[model samples]
Target: IDGGLLSPEAVAADPCPHGMTRELCGLLCGDDDPAVTVDPDRPVGFALALDCQLAGDSPELLDDAQLLDVVEGAERMERWASALRTRMLAVFADRHPPGSSAPPPGADSGAAAPVGRWLPDQVALTLRVSLEEARCMLAGAVRFAHVLPATLAEWEAGRIDERKADAIAHATSVLTDEVAREVEARVLPGAAAAPRRLLQDRLRRTVARVDPQGAARRHERAKADRRMSISRSDDGMASLWLSAAAEQTEASWRSVDRLARSLG
Candidate 1:
């Protein structure tokens, strides 16, 4: 059977009679099988299961909406993990410098310890990559975070790895000032306050098209509601605290009335 067009069941069954490895299995599984465990004891079995999942005859088995959700969730997890690794590397690199075999100021105790005495065997185990790979990833992350100069100094100290650096970089890139502004525009309350801003905009446009004067009146009303504050009691019930100003109160009432009419 062609590798590209094998059924799920067929893929599950051992495709290669000779012998297969866990890494190969993972490649086949495509990364979202909870049942596909990967550990020292059952590495081979895990690998095989993954291979089957990946090699399953129809791609549809993994391309459905549900699968897409899984992929998205996994991507998010990986991205976060990568970010964490980067942060860890940065911290370590700051502690240890490159080429010099001297420990930090406080690292020296009583007599004398080993040359690399402060090196922890497992600084951050969550980083599944080797120290070298982690350092590289960290480098990428530092670059992304716009803190490359400081991060580079840390990296030279032998505290972080590449993977972590890369993750930090990626997270920083996604959280740029521009992206923050976009998010604020969409979700923040000041200007485009409502959850349905687009809907409101469309409604306003429609109302204006139907009745220009009414639309203007309605717009004023909306502005009034924004000015009106809402306070919540200890029990969580909200109370509208209308302005004491007569003109403002009248505007608020008009806004409420307009909204009611629009809803009806």
Candidate 2:
């Protein structure tokens, strides 16, 4: 009935028999008695924690080999969960399927009906997420699962993380299939090593290079579609939101900053 013992995190943070705190939160808990008893701050204890899927006690415990494996393993777990979510999204997408030959209730018999009509609503309800999040994730899942094999492979191997994969996905979305492969070939190698912001800039640049016409069209569209809105915050505040070309937005932001500083 101990509340702290309720999760693996609690277990690893428990004290070791040696009186030094166990490095892992869950590796030393639950009365199972570790087969190898050592301070989690030590290599054996850290390895044991990682092997058992608990949080590591400390980074110092990992050797170069263990460090590599543990970091890669963390990414592998993220990749696995993303793949699982994609499959689950597929289950929802296929509940009625998008391209059924049959007509819907209000349609003529020969017309092709849109199926899976309730997918976003059902997903939101089941996952307890907002409808916007559900729809975006569903779209991302479909894109990642079906179209981006190279990025997916890199992510699965832990060579790249979800954010980088997402960056690749967003950058390539406007590209034709042939052009996207070219972009992937150029971008995927550096994704894991590059900081995400730097990778995003590179990816955008590459996408422009690989598909100049498409990039130009999207840029023009973005410029033309600049939008602003007012939204109320939960804490009795209001936010003025605006989205436009980067240069224009930055200029506007600088003006606001200048005005605010002048009064101060």
Candidate 3:
């Protein structure tokens, strides 16, 4: 679980108490419960069961013991990918220093600043994603490297998922360095086992407690940017977007609900 490689003999010596094979037990560090046997033939089933367990749901399949290996393997792969992403972003940052807005020599004259404005185009082309998606990816990588070092370390170590890392980064993005560290330190210890929404809620409370005045100030500034927009698709379906103060949005929702109920 800690990523230390074990020899085949070492793994064979430490079989799971719950009837799991040496390979599966060694890979997943044994099942959480001694009574629940992990099926060696179907590690993926155990992984699905664990997911359903985490989601407060139940799986009807095979008593939930087959999916462990697949889940653990996928998590390890994602951790490696995340680490690679950070390294790539580091290379990008090094080439396009935030302070130096000039384009690389012999590059297009259209490559103007907000430094690194043109780099995401290269990433987009390489990764087969839209320009905006690549830009967001770079932004997130930068945030992890610069503002959320502990979160980055955990992500690299495979202790937390990238989504959880994103939650921490987004929640603390508005805080000052000192306050952000404090909030991060308080919530990060148990982050590996915490659900994304629960982790986000914890981050919110920690931020409020750590810097009430700063939170209030940011809220005020954010309110100034509040607006509404709508997007329409070719299928005649439309989606509305509201960026507003929380209380204001809630009040509007309540009014709409009341009118809808009266009409009904």
Candidate 4:
């Protein structure tokens, strides 16, 4: 049975101290009749009213042209949105700039608890995402805004997607700001034509030449995080994953291949 929004029973049972008006309730419920119940899964309420209203205006019959138009629009706009997200995050960072004194003046240095310490938690609650997921997203936004202008511009122009932009940012992370920009400028021109691994390799070489000291430091830091794990796949097959230096990983693979061949 469909629930009524403005029915007397609903008004009487409403949580508000003062009964909700039928007019206000009608506006809140937004299918065909404002007085009807809202199904959140297939929402036509105040939240999705604009989009729902536009979709309703279109003919029920959707042809190939309409479908293609929607897909194309989504692809283009997604890139634009990625660029805009960087800007939005820039504003957010300014408001709560990292290293900006979390505490006010005159407070004891040890006693000052940083403001916005719960930023990731706040973002998680607002976006209905896990804290780890929120931190990852925030990290990506910061990278795109501050680290990868060339990649962000490419995405804005619809030449690349968010994944490739992030890949560029992460691959060049160890370089100094000047070197990272130089590497990005050199790599982006051929990005659309090149495989992702090729770009990563090029970035690695660029880092090794441009800032060898920084690269070595990063390598040492990465070595601290290296490990291996084994797990069973859904089909009961065993799988192994290793995090290690590229050179050592390749040597290990080669040794394993030779051992298997000798056994055969």
Best candidate (score: lDDT): 3
As a TM-score, model 1 comes out at 0.25
lDDT of each: 0.45, 0.68, 0.70, 0.65
TM-score to native of every candidate shown: 0.25, 0.60, 0.63, 0.59
Q: Please give, for residues 1-264, the per-residue lDDT of candidate 1 as tens digits.
A: 246545556766856443444444444566565233222122223333444444343345554554544443343334444445556655665545444355434555554344244333233244555656655554554353444443333333223333333322333343444442333233223222223444345433433454566546655776765555888888769888765445677887899999999998
Residue-by-residue lDDT tens digits, candidate 4, 46-154: 3233323333345243455544444444455566676666657555655666655454334566755554565666567766989898777777777667777678777
1 against 4, candidate with superior lDDT: 4
Report the lDDT tens digits of candidate 3 across residue range 1-264: 335455566667874334334334433564454333332233233343443243222223324343454356456546656766776776686678666676644578776566666677777887899999988888877767776788888877667877888888889988887777888899999998899889999999989999999889988999999999999988789988999999999998999899999998
Give candidate 4 misplaced runs (Cα > 4 Å). 1-73, 99-115, 220-228, 232-236, 243-247, 261-264
Least accurate stretch of 10 residues (summed lDDT) in model 4? 36-45
Candidate 2 wrong stretches, greater than 4 Å: 1-72, 84-97, 100-139, 234-236
Q: Which stretches of candidate 1 lie above 4 Å from their native place?
A: 1-63, 97-264
Best-first order by TM-score: 3, 2, 4, 1
